[model samples]
Each structure stands twice: as structure tokens, then as C-alpha cells.
Target chain A: MSGKVTNGAGGSGDGGDGSEGTPELDAAFFARWMTAAADAVAREADRLTELDSAIGDSDHGGNMRRGFEAVREELGEEVPATPGAVLMTAGRKLVSTVGGASGPLYGTLLRRAGKALGSAERVSREELAGALRTGIDAVAQLGGAVAGDKTMLDALFPAVEALADSGGKDFEAARTAAEQGAEETVPLQARKGRASYLGERSIGHQDPGATSAALLVAALAEADTAVEPEGDADGTGSAQGGSGGSE
Target chain B: MVEAHGGKRVGIVLVSHSKEVADSTARLAAGLAGVPDALVAGAGGLPDGSLGTSEELIVEAARRMDEGAGVALLADLGSAVLTVKTLLAEGDELPEPARLVDAPLIEGAVAAVVTAAGGGDLDTVAAAAEEAYTYRKL
Candidate 1:
């Protein structure tokens, strides 16, 4: 689901200049990204719960829905002054509203990433990528999980890695990487989270957390495409040209 | 009713996914400590009374238990622990110097309540709760 740039105002730099190699996303962009993520979560809540029912406590969908709805309401109440503030506020809301491991894990990711972003009015793609890596690391440390543990990190680590390596301009590539990573979890035996309690039964079920993570990354790509339709001709072109090989 | 032991002791908090469990455990711990007036509170369930932990409830319980000394929190199950961890990481919502004691829920609550009733400080109360992890049930 693409989130149209309804409020492209505020923040220090207006990143739509065609001369710049990469656009500097502002607070509004991050807000729009979160809102888009919330919308996606709401749309796929049932699927998430279904996936969780297979291995988890079957509350992932409801937990994520409640948390993201709170984020949307908080963002609607008052858009923060900077990207970091927006992320931090959203993280706090998630931590308080969502009552599960996902709550703290996702909350920590956003909070740590927001803290890394500091109070910058605008952030470059590279800065955003690095900050996301920092956030993912925080989630890993909080959850005591790694890539092959069949958790959200499975999707998140690959997506951030792809984004960082692409000089932080290839949100589409990151999205695809995240989707592939999520799919790869279907064959993995979980070593972390509640799913690990199921032991061998955890196999053959796609991780709900990784699936939602993919949706989040997909929303990011959608936000990027929506923000500047013509900024990344290659991005938009490849996106429209279908999911072809990006090597 | 147990009298105040000359000073406020470390507050004890019990957290669980079910409100009933937390409430009863709190009652049982206080009763076992022989101090019916010990500073202890129970937090559990979601706002809708569902079977899930709530940070709002946990913070509220912590605030109620905080008596200028500090609070020692014990949680049951997955999200209960995670929710407490989240609050601890935030560090600004709960009372100053709150801690999440790692121990068996009922045993830890009993140990913490007894120590607090005896006017134990934060560290001592926490250590007492942790020591319950190795207590012999036989």
C-alpha cells in the first residue's frame, strides 16, 4: 500500500530538488512512512494472526494492530518537530500500548533508531540506512535473536543490509530483500521467541514477525516512491518495470 | 494490619498476564510474610481485562507501591517480563530505582514481601527475591 505525501511541508530542507543525487527525507517523510506502515498492518492483521496461530500465541495481529493504531492516533494528535521526535514518539506509543515481546522489540527498534537520528531536521538516505541498522541491532540485543532465528531480524537484517550497501537510495531493493528474507523463514526452525517453545512444529510456518517486517519495508519503498515520483527514475522505472533482477 | 517498621521499606510489585493471578499472589505473599500492611501491589491483564500484560497497569502498580524507597517488580510469563523490561528500559515512567527481579513469581513475591516488611532496602529486597530461585521446596 502506497502512502501519498499529503503533508510535504515543514522540516529544514525540501528534498525534491532534481539536482541532488539522493533526496534528504524530512520529519514529514518519516511520519508518512509510519502511517503507511500502520495502514499496512491494519490491512493484514488477520493474515498476521493466522500466521501466529500456527506457532505463536496467535496475538501478533491484534497486538500490532493495537500498537499501530495508537501510533496513528498519536501522530495525528501532533506531528513531532523532527524525524527523531516522530520516531521516538511512535516508539513510546508502541511500547505503552502493545503488550507483548513485539511491543518492546519493535518499540526499541524505533526508539533506538530515532535516538540515532538525533534531532536532525532532515536526514540523508545513508543516515537513515545506518540509523535503521542501529535500530535492528537494538532489537536483536533486546530479543537475544539473530538472522537465522526465524524472527523479525530475518527480514530486517537483510533489508537494512541491502539499503546500506546501495548507498541508502534503493528502498525498492531493500523491500525485495525483506520479502525474500521473510519467505526464507518458512523452512527455518525457530530458535527464539515463543515459537521456539513449539520445537520442531515451528517448521513450515512463516514467521509472523518477519512477514510484518516485510510489510513495513514495503511501505517504506512505497513512501519513497510516493514522496518523489521522478527523483529516482531508476527506482520508479524498475518498480514499474516489475520485480526484475537487481544485481 | 502490620505496623510501619520505623521507615518505608522497598515496595514489592507482582506482575502477571492475568489480573486474578497477580492479585491473589500479592495477597498470598503478604499473608505469608505475616505483614498484611506490607507495601505491595499487583498489576496484570490488558486494559480490557484480556489475557495479556499492560504497561499502563504495571506503571500504575509501581507508582502505588513506590514509598520513596524504590520498587522491586516480579513478572510471570513472556509478555509480562517483556512489558516490565520495556518500562525499565524507558526508565522515566516508573518510580525511581525500580528493578525487575529474576525469580519464580510466587516464591519471589513471598521473599520480597517478607524482606520489605522487615524494612529492607531496594538491593536487599531484590536479592531476597532472587534467592528464592534456589529455595528448596522439598
Candidate 2:
């Protein structure tokens, strides 16, 4: 699950001097990332609701779709100048438009990351990684969920860990980690959120929050691949890169 | 038909997943208290009248019921509580004061409304709501 950094095509040019040559992710990347997230959520809305119906309310899918649609609409109205501004606005929209515990939880994640990014027009991979850690931590704090709680944290915590462990150079790795973490939730009883009311009955059902969270990381990977296609001619850089490091 | 509450007393907001639940609960609590002066509003369900809480509705309720004294919020179930907390966290500027009380819905609403009718302050009315938590039917 962790290893040495292998410079992939996406990360090749940086001198490893650690700062001056670091690639700066721009607002365009953030916009594409959010759009990808909305698309993924829309595509999987019914599945998410089905998952929730097993252990919780059957509205997770609809709620997430509505929230992300609101985010897209807000972004369409006026594009923010910086990544932080874009994320902050998106977070605000989610909190206002989404009506469940997930709204505030996901809202805090993006808003905290946006605040950590500050007013910077762009951010280094490392900077983004740190900011994401803060964002996920805010989610944990707000929801009172830890990795084993069968909540979104089950997916989010591992994904963040993968991002940091990879020095933020591999979005694919994080996405895979998130997906795997979400899958792992199928066997665990929920210890938090509305699902906790189900007790042992919650086991065997995949957590809807964790499933959606995985889609978010997968969207991040897709956006990363799209923005930096130099070393990713096959469009499969992160997966290969992640595998290489573990070897 | 009953006369509306006419004084600057603590307000009450009932939050529930069902519109019928919130509205009926508010009516029952208001009736039990018989206080025409206490402002009570219901924030429940989606705009389409589905079974779910809405932050917009809650904020609107808080805005309308607030009178300079304060507002006590009573919520049913998990998502309802989360929605109310999230709304308050977003920094909406409600007139006067507001507090989210952790207590049983129907019983707490009755206690809270009665306490507010007597001109209780924010904390006092909230305490009255909390007191319902200890009420037992043995």
C-alpha cells in the first residue's frame, strides 16, 4: 500500500528540488474535476440509493445528484478565478442544496480544503495533497466517523493516505485505494450515521456514502489524466505508476 | 380558530422529515400550551412535500418566528437534526437568538411551547425542552 516514488511521465520534468519546479494545478483542473464528479454521481445515482436502502434512508443517490447538479449550475453562473474560490463556492452550494448529513459532511470537506488552499491561483501536487488531508479530517470531525465506521471515511481515509504516500503524484492510486476501501465496507456493520440504527443488519451492504466518495476520487483521477496527458499517452499512467511504486 | 400569540416571547421551530409530522406536531404543542403569544413554525419535508428535511425551510422558519427573544429548535430523527445543525452552521442571520435543543420531539415541543408562553428566555425554554428527556410514563 506504500512505496518509493517513481517519476511517471506526468511528474518527470520537475527537478525534485521540491519547490521551484513543482507543477501548479490551476482552476481549470478544479472545474473539470468537479464536472467529472457530477457526471459520475448522476450516472450512479440509483445504485447509491439502492445501497442506502439496505441500511439507511433510500435518498442518498437523489440527494447527491441534486447537490452536484446545484454545484454544476452554480459553477455555470460564474466561474471563480482560483481553485480555492471554485471549491469554496461548490461547498457552499452543497450545504445549501443538499438536505442530509452528507451535505454538511461533504461541504466541510471541500470548504476546508479550499480555505487551506488560500488565495493561491494554483497549487503544487504536494500542496493539494496537504489541503485534501485537512478537508477529509474536517469531514471526520464533523461526522464523528473513523475509518472503520462504515461511512464515507472508510473510502476517504485510505484515498487521502494513498495521495500523501504517493506524494500526490498519482491520482489513479488514490482512486483505486478509495474504490477498494469502499468495497471493503460490504462486510462491516455501520457504527455511525443513520445506518447505525440497523445494528448488525447493516453488514453485507455497501455504504452509499463510501461508494459516492470513491466516485469523487475516480473523478479526480480522470481530471488529472485529462489535464496532463504528456506521459499518459495510453491514459493509464496512475494505475501503472501506482503499481510500479509498490513493486 | 385561536388568537395568535401577540408578544415578544421565545419562538419554537419543529423540524421533522414529514411535512404532516412537523405541522401537526406544532399544532398539537401550540394547543397544549394555549399560548397565542409564542411564535411556532414548522420546517419539514422537501418543497415537493416528500419525506425529508430542508435547510431552506428551516432557515425560513427561524427567520419568521424569531422576535428578539430567541428560537428553540426541536428536531425528529437523525437527518432532521443534521439539517438544522448545518443551517445554523452556515451563519444565517436570524433576528434575536436561537438554540437547537436535544430532546424528544412531541413531548419536548409541548414543554418548550409552554415555557416560552410564560415569557421564558432562550435557555429557559430550551431547558424546558430538555426536561422532557427525563419524563417517564410508568
Candidate 3:
């Protein structure tokens, strides 16, 4: 009952699910999540670059920091009206700023996902899960790589699958899944991206893209917990309020 | 002016992680093609003068080269290719009919310029560039 705090306007009714009591997340929630991700990327930039130096280009850290910083700046200047708008804007910024493969890859992920969300003012957890799948699939197609490739998909696939299967309520589980997935990349000989050039030498090095992907998922969980401290225990949040009651 | 067969010549762009590489390739290709008026541009390097391809630069170059005949882009390496692909995927801001040609940089640029100077359309020019892979030096 505490999760029912519908205050959002414009019932997009895009969720289609019959679960009317599910909480809905707005643009502000998505902005908060992106900001949290920016902070996390900034804090771990050096670690990420170090990991990349072991097997791939040594620019992943700097590129990610620059890209997220642009995202943070753009969002701060003008917060978009809807969650989809915010993500789309952020994705464009990343694409234009980051001067590496990560830019386009990450840009496609957010842009496609945002496009899937459409103009819904508020999206339920289930809706968000579906949108994320659309985004992740775009990533795989763009990169021409699949799971076990020691690429970002190593972490992203598991995180999205876990999030979707849990009806998008288990951010903690998604975060844990992402972290484990990244860790598992340490022993994998890369089959895609720059690391693939190293052949067997790429083994024993954790994939920097996977590491950053884990941080992004962890940031999502952190953003949710920061908004609803009480929801941390039951895996629900106050930010995910509105729109669900209208439909 | 290089005469087009029946329409305007297709534009060519060389995208590389290094400015020097892109510019030099453009110069070599244009010089060898003997078409001073050909629309060939070089877009390379980040805004900070680093060794990376800039999406902004690619978009700018493509726009500058676009003359309603479409633009063909040849990228040097990983990030350069990705950047061009990203622009193609976004599709709105970039000029209409821009394509990424998957061919070796120097040879492809030369071939594309030669073909374009001969008044080839976008598809013909791109095919010529990609056909560089089959050129035999031996």
C-alpha cells in the first residue's frame, strides 16, 4: 500500500500490464540514476583505465569520465520533461563527447531504450524492464558481439535479464548479477573489441567495459536507495510513484 | 571543374584517429586523382587534439562535403569506424545518404576520389572504394 503514491499526470497506459498497484518512476528518477552513474564513473575512472591498459586501449576511463560529465552537464542545464527525453538527451551527449567505441555503444544503449519508452511521463518497473531489453539488444547488434565475448554485454545481459525477471523491483539483485558478470570476464579471452587483438594474452584481465557496465547498474541501485531509504529493506521505492493508479 | 556524368559527384571523407593521417590521405588521394575541385574532406582527432575520432568532427565534415550527391566515409580504425556507424545509426542530424565504407583507409580514399572525380554516384563511388581490397600490387 505504501508503494501506491500516484501523482504523475498523463496516463500513457504504455505499461499494458494489469498490475495497477505497481509504483511508477518519473523523469526525475531517471535523471537521478544518470547522475549517480556519472559520479560513480568519475570516482572509478582511474581503476577502469588501469583495467583497460592491461588488455585494451588505456582510454576507457578518460572517455567514460568525459562522456558522463557531459551527460551530467546537459541534464543539469535542462531536465527533460519525460524519462525518455532525459535518457535520449544523455545518450546523444555521450555519443558526441566520448571519443571512443564506448561512446557509440553506450549511446545506442540509452538512445534505443529511451525511444522504446516513448513519451510516457511515468513508467512502471515492468515497462522499464522491457525498454532496457530493447536497448541492450541494440547494443549487441551494433557491436556484432554476443555473450561470453568479454565485452560490455558480459555484464549488461545478465543485469537486464535479472532486472526483467524480477519485474524490475530487484535492483540489488541486478547489481550483484552485474558485478559477478564483470568479475567472470577476468578469465575470459576476449572475442570482441580491442582486447580481441591480444588473443590469449587478453586472458586474466577483467574487461574494462564490463567493469564500467557493473558500475552503471550499481549506480541504478544506489539512486533508488538514495530516493527511498525505507524501500531498501523491502526492495521498493518512493521515487517509483505516480501513473500506476491512473490506469 | 571535374565533370559529373549526369549529376553532381559523390563526396568523400576520410576519418582517422590522427589528424595528420586523415589530412595526408586526403591530400594524396586528391593529388593522384588530379581533381582539384573534388569534394574530399578529412575529419580526424578529438577536440583536445588527442588520438581519437570525434563524432562532432565527422558530422561537420559530412555536412560540409554533402552537395545533395551523398557522402562516403572511409575510417582508419576501431573508434573511427564506430563513430561513423554511430552517426549513421542516429541518422537525423547527419546529412542524408551518408554511408560508412569498409575498406582500407589510404587505398580506399584514393579509389573513392578517383571514382568520384569520374562523376560516379554515391553507390558507384562507395563500391569503388570497397573494391580497393581487391587491388593487387604484386
Candidate 4:
């Protein structure tokens, strides 16, 4: 686990080597990232809820939409000066506004990552990847859900792995990996969260949390493309909706 | 605040997926001999009164119920407990010394509330809650 996190951070200084020479991400990038996430959640809210209805409470989509909407409002109200501040503030809002386990779970993810980012004004892609690993670790600790639990970790762990493998330069690759991971949850029996109660009935449905988590990665990739369109034109930006499989 | 019970007692919060479950559990615990004056708050259900837990509601209840003493939370389900822990991790301006008691929900809430109402302090209430795990009804 620590090895993976360290490898993700190893590419922090190689920002200029990418095809587009991506700059260090600042607070503005974080803000845009969150806004994109909010939009994606809104657009996919019903699909998420439908996925949850099969094995869970069918509220994951609504919960995510409400949380991200609150985050967007907070960001618009008072834009934080640093990336950590942006994430921490958004995390706190998610905790307060969103109900259920996902609120706290997702909130802890961002808050832990934000804490790891510390007071840095800007962060290299590798630094962000490392910080995200810290966040995901916190999520696992909080939820007690491992990678095969048919939870968000199903998508998140693989996405983090892809990010590290690419040295954090390939957000699109991470997004694809997350989508594939989410799709992989369709055949898994849930061992955590509300869906675990369904037992074998959960085997055929894609995990709602995992699906929404993929959307979060998609949103981040979209935000990256919006900022550095020229840098990401090398076939990485073309795969818009490869998130296959029915819930 | 004046101590009608003669000393500061640990407060209690009941967290459940169902609002009625939390409220009724608090009521059941409150019926005990020493629990009339103890602060017992019910935090359950979504804002729209649906069947789910809410971290915001739990934090608000914990804040409202805590006096000079600490707060002990008893959750009915795993998600309820997770929600409470997550809210606590968010560093809300809750009173000092709030804890989640890990024991059977109704039994633990009853025991913890009874112990706390008797001025058992934080550790005593927690122990009483844990002791409920050994209670056999057979």
C-alpha cells in the first residue's frame, strides 16, 4: 500500500514531459474539478438510484447530487485560495449536507486527501495522486470495505493503481480503469454496506457506489481536458462513455 | 445550568435508520428509574423523513444533548455507526468527549442511559453499554 502511494508521488517533477506540458494544478483547478463532478452527478443521478434500487436503498444518486450541489454552492460563495482549502471545504460540506454512509465516506476521502495536501498553493499531478491514495486509504478505514466488497473501493483502488502506473500524467487512463472497475462489480456479491443484506441477490447488479465513483473520475478527466485540451488530444480524450454493463 | 439531578451526567444519543426506532428506544431508556433528567436525543431518518441515517442530524443532536459532561452514541445498525463516526471525524464543534458505544442497540442504549442518568460518568456509561453484550435473556 505504501509502495503504491510512493510510486504515485515519484512523478511529481515530470510535469513538462507530457505531450501538452500540463501545469501544476492550483485552487482554480480543484474548483473546476468539483463543479464538473457536481454536473456529472446531476446528470447521472437517476441511473445511480436505479442501480441502487436493485440491491440497496436507491438513494445513492440523490445523495451524491445533493452533496455535490452543496459543494458547488459553497465553492461559488467563497472560493478558497489553495487546493487543500478547496477540497477540505468541499469535504466538510459533503459531510453536513449529504445524508447516509456515502456522505461521510466520500467526505472523509476528500478531507483526508486535503489534509495530505497540506498548505501547498499548487500541486503536481503526482502529488495529487499521492494525496488521493491517502484519501482512499482513509475511506477504506472508515468503511471497512476492501477492494472486492462490491463497494466504491472496487472502482477507486483500480483507478488509483492506474494513476500510479501512469505516474499521474494520464487522468484519462485512470478514468478508463475506474470505469472498467465499476463494470467489474456487476458479478460480485456485496459484502459491505446496505447491499450486503441482499446476499446472493447482489451478484448481478453493478454497485451503485462504484458507478458513482466512476462518474467522479469521469468528471475529473473532463475538468482536466477543459483546462489542457491540447495536451490530452492523443486519443486519451476520445473515450467519453465506455462505462458499460447493466445494473 | 443548574443540576437538577445533583451532578453532571453523561448524555445519550440513539442513532437508527428509522426515526421511530430511535425515538422509541430513547423513550424506553428514559422510563428507567434514574433517567428522567438525563439528556437523551434521537437522531435518525433523512431530512425528508425517509428511512436512513443522517450525520448532520446526529451532530446536531449530540451538540444539543451534551451538557458539561460527555455524550454516548448508540447506533441501531452498521451504517448508523459509520455515519456517526464519520460526522465525528469531520470535526464539528461538538462538545468535548463524545464516543460511540459498540454494543447491541436497544440493550446498550438502555444500559448506558440508565448508568449515565445515575451519574456514572463517561467510562461507567461506556462500560455499562458494553456489559449489555453479555446479557442473556434465555
Best-matching candidate per TM-score: 3
Model 2 misplaced stretches (Cα beyond 4 Å): A1-18, A21-23, A228-247, B1-7, B93-96
**Consecutive 10-residue window with the lowest summed lDDT within model 4 chain A:** A238-247
Error of model 1, residue A105, in angstroms? 1.0
What is the lDDT ranking, best to worst? 3, 1, 4, 2
Interface RMSD of each: 1.3, 1.7, 0.9, 1.6
DockQ leaderboard ranking: 3, 1, 4, 2
Q: Choose 1 or 2, whichever is better by TM-score.
A: 1
Q: Weakest 10 consecutive residues, lDDT, candidate 3 chain A? A: A1-10
- The DockQ value obtained for model 3 is 0.76
For all predicted structures, in order, the TM-scores are 0.87, 0.86, 0.89, 0.87
Q: Model 2's DockQ?
A: 0.42
TM-score of 3: 0.89
Candidate 1 structure quality by residue, lDDT tens digits, B31-135: 889887448888988878887888889999899888888899999987788778878876499998899999899999999899888888888888889999898
Model 4 alpha-carbon drift over 4 Å, by segment: A1-23, A228-247, B1-6
Report the TM-score of candidate 1, chain A only: 0.84
Residue A194 error for model 2, in Å? 2.6
* B39: Cα error in model 4, Å: 2.3
Give the DockQ-based CAPRI class for model 2: acceptable
Q: Which structure among the candidates has the greatest lDDT?
A: 3
Docking class of 4: medium
lDDT of 3 by residue, A118-146 (tens): 88787777777788889999999888999
